[model samples]
Target: MAVPEGEISDALQVLRRVFGYDAFREGQGEIIEHVVAGNDALVLMPTGGGKSLCYQIPALVRKGVGVVISPLIALMQDQVDALRNAGVRAGFLNSTQDLDERRVVEAQFVAGELDLLYLAPERLKVASTVQLLDRGDIALFAIDEAHCVAQWGHDFRPDYLLLSGLHERWPDVPRIALTATATQATRTEIASRLNLEQARHFVASFDRPNIQYRIEPKNEPKRQLLHLLRTEHSGDAGIVYCLSRNSVEKIAEFLTANGIEAVPYHAGLDPRTRAENQSRFLREDGLVVVATIAFGMGIDKPDVRFVAHLDLPKSVEGYYQETGRAGRDGLPSTAWLAYGLNDVVNLRKMIDTSEGDAAHRRRLSVHLDAMLALCETVECRRVQLLNYFGQDGEPCGNCDTCLTPPESWDGTIAAQKLLSAIVRLDRERRQKFGAGHVIDILTGKKNAKVIQFDHDALSVFGVGSELRDTEWRGVVRQLLAQGLLAVESNYGALVLTDTSPEVLKGARKVMLRREPEPTKAAKAAKTAKERKAPVDLPSEAMPVFERLRTWRAAQAKDQGVPAYVIFHDATLREIATAMPSSLTELGKISGVGENKLAKYGNQVLETLTPA
Candidate 1:
């Protein structure tokens, strides 16, 4: 994607005048310039990496209204509001709107009064919607969340499959497909599915250095999550992801009971409740959202301080995307996950029972394997995460592993003992048991299930006495991850794979990552001390910052928009530090574009001034 001479000035002008950024971040200028010059593009940038600017700048600089195809209907209001706040004439037509509201936006688009018009992907299916668009000239088509085109992706949208025809219908309109998450395979599928194979592709580095990666072995996970919120991210906005709707509801209620302002979102919730909870989370400060992967796509909130996982995410792409929701403001944030053996077994069972051929199951297993490797890795979490997305990165000292590195040990004997126990149960007893029963037998615990299931007189029983229950569970988890062992499809019982023979024969040695112990507390406290502020806020400016936030909340309430639409935290940080005395001075700050300067500059000055 080359920036043609004399063409980028328009984009740079829009960047400064409309978006109020002095210059482009790493890869944005080229994408914007390429699209502005009537060329198609596919952009792959990390979340909060100025992805919107890649298309928004080109939309502002191009001739006709830029028609954007978006997937989330609930978010269109805020997205459009943010654009309108920055002085761009933006409107959206979604199912949430009444017929009258849709007509107004349609008229505006047809009249060429809107700089950008957003449509839900499903809307493109309507004959009337296509006819309405046919009546207006399109500047360019921007397909946002383009990764949804992947058939098996977690966020796949069937309506997105219709997008390939956009280029066919309007052959002259340059189309740019953009997404914050995609691997090379998903990227290729997107390009082919969207009929953009010829489009110039721009893939930005997937590293989000500001986010600290932390994956803890699951142990009283709800309590661990509470500790994380209370000690590190108290009174800060964040997202917590869970794998089930029941888990989402329970976690939300537990947090609320413990005095944290938490809300739940899931597909099972009524639409109104879901929308209200989402709006509240976005508009209010210091709120936490506990959800399945149903929430937090294209969430533009810049002040989110952490993203915690109560259960293991099934794939690295999802983990990265969900955690990428945090630290969007270029501020330090945490991506914390709590994983255990149950999570691994359950996800494998789900994939086995999942609808699809063997290929689909294999693809899913591949995703799960990568995720498991990430959780069990002794190396840097950030490095493994970046490498998963085909990017290289050094060990960032910010992640849990780099902060207090875990130890690796030859767990060959332990692994051999565990495998022997399973083998005896299968061969002699002619029965299979899940990890719990197996561990109970190995640790010689005469629990009720163990007693009911068997005579404890098995030969391999009690051989795993050298390691504690948790350590034995760790070995089982690693063996499962390493493909030497697997969960039975029907009952989730531990079963040996073909690779098990090599390990049993001592042909291959088993190495396992030893969990870092209580040193995590010291590391956490040090990290917490460093991340106390939103990011780089001086102590003297704290009062001004708090006062400004209060005023902004009031303004957002009056305007009925998310607070970020009024002024992002980054913008407010700049204002508080500068402590401008006049509207002229306030107007010069970044993110105070022309409309906002004229609209809110005086109020900002008044807020900064003494009462």
Candidate 2:
């Protein structure tokens, strides 16, 4: 079933007339070509890398409806809505739809009225659903968020494990599995589990240079978050991720109290309330979502200005995927985090106490260690992140490290002192203690526990008095990150690993990063300037942008959809900058597809016209 030459021309027309893009982004054309040729593909593209177009254009060019297996029901609706708005015949069937609605969509699919159909994986398990799908002509099977199939991934869905049935049932249909985040391990698991082992793999660059990475020590984290919102990301849409439901509620309340429009979202809330909060965050401009890990998968919002983490994430892959949600429109965005040693201890305790075999626990430990390394790395954050996914990149100047280089000092003595304290406490007292106790002993702080245990007279006691309390904490954190120190899972006790002996014997030299100074006024000013509207519209065009936004908001409200569904801020900025006077001129601008131009052309022109 090779695509005819004329159909290729039709695909290009759909790209321009329907999708409003003149040319294909990098790797999109290749993937589309392969799919149109009825080949399987495994695409590992970054967030905001235009992955939808890879399967979308090919679906239009081919003869049958494209069946996209999405994980989330909400995501399916969002995609279907966007496609319908673009004038594509797209529909979705999920649990949310009633039998009548499902039958209507099924009739449309059977009648060849739909260009694309979205389905949750669970639907494929039903005999009736399978019979319905079997009766239709499926163009290809496109698996969105393919990484969910990996058992080790953070967002693994039990339903995704059933996706392999697609290949077994419809061997003739070309399949394309796509995800925004996947490491080498996760990629292999996705390919193997989804029966895409023979599929051609396309691994795009994992770097998102538009996002500026910054990690600060947790000191009055709420105040720090407020400063970030007020000073850097004023009047912008963003997400705040906490580790617990209580924290999400409190933070959301705190933000709202401070005059910032914020909403809370977590699994603990009523489903309707969570849905409403998510809807508000999506529909309203400048509304922040304070949520836990339960939120933020498959979100299509493109103008999020920042993603702030109130606590440390579980793994590097998780951190990368979460932070990658920001600056998705290729605008300068920030990924700010406030973390301290408590995050490490808490995460370790979680891993240790969780039900798992030794092997499973070991894998979890490795993932956490990688995340901690990223947080503690003195080198380029982007480089470290990319390297974790098996990509090589130079220092990205946008990250905090490259912006303000931190001084590194040889911490061999500091390491020996800490290891010595751990070993002496264990051997002499037959007791294991956490970092705080070790630091107390090292800095000559004879608290009641130390005096009670007679640890005030240890040989290593007071040996590390030269370094401050914060500095010692840094050393211990780095040691844990480097695997020289391990936290016991059950009791949260710190223990030495095999690597600790090397540092204790002076065979290995340790380097620790000096904590960066507080954010200065000059730096804040520079960041504020950088966080302005991404478009380069002239000063005179500012009013036009505002007017366009107002019109878009009205349209979105009328349609009960997110404003970006009508037109993204980037598209509006383009329209304002270009100031196209005619429908033809408006269609020439990117993102103004033929359907949109026909639908809103007159309104846009009237808005642009002089009063």
Tell me, by lDDT, which candidate is best: 1
lDDT scores in order: 0.89, 0.88
C-alpha displacement of 107 in model 2, angstroms?
A: 1.6
Candidate 1, lDDT over the whole model? 0.89
- In model 2, what lDDT does residue 410 have? 92
The CA lDDT at 507 in model 1 is 95
Looking at model 2, residue 319 earns an lDDT score of: 87
Q: TM-score for each prediction?
A: 0.98, 0.96
Question: What value does the lDDT take at residue 295 in candidate 1?
Answer: 96
Weakest lDDT window of 10 consecutive positions for candidate 2? 519-528
lDDT of 2 at 521: 31
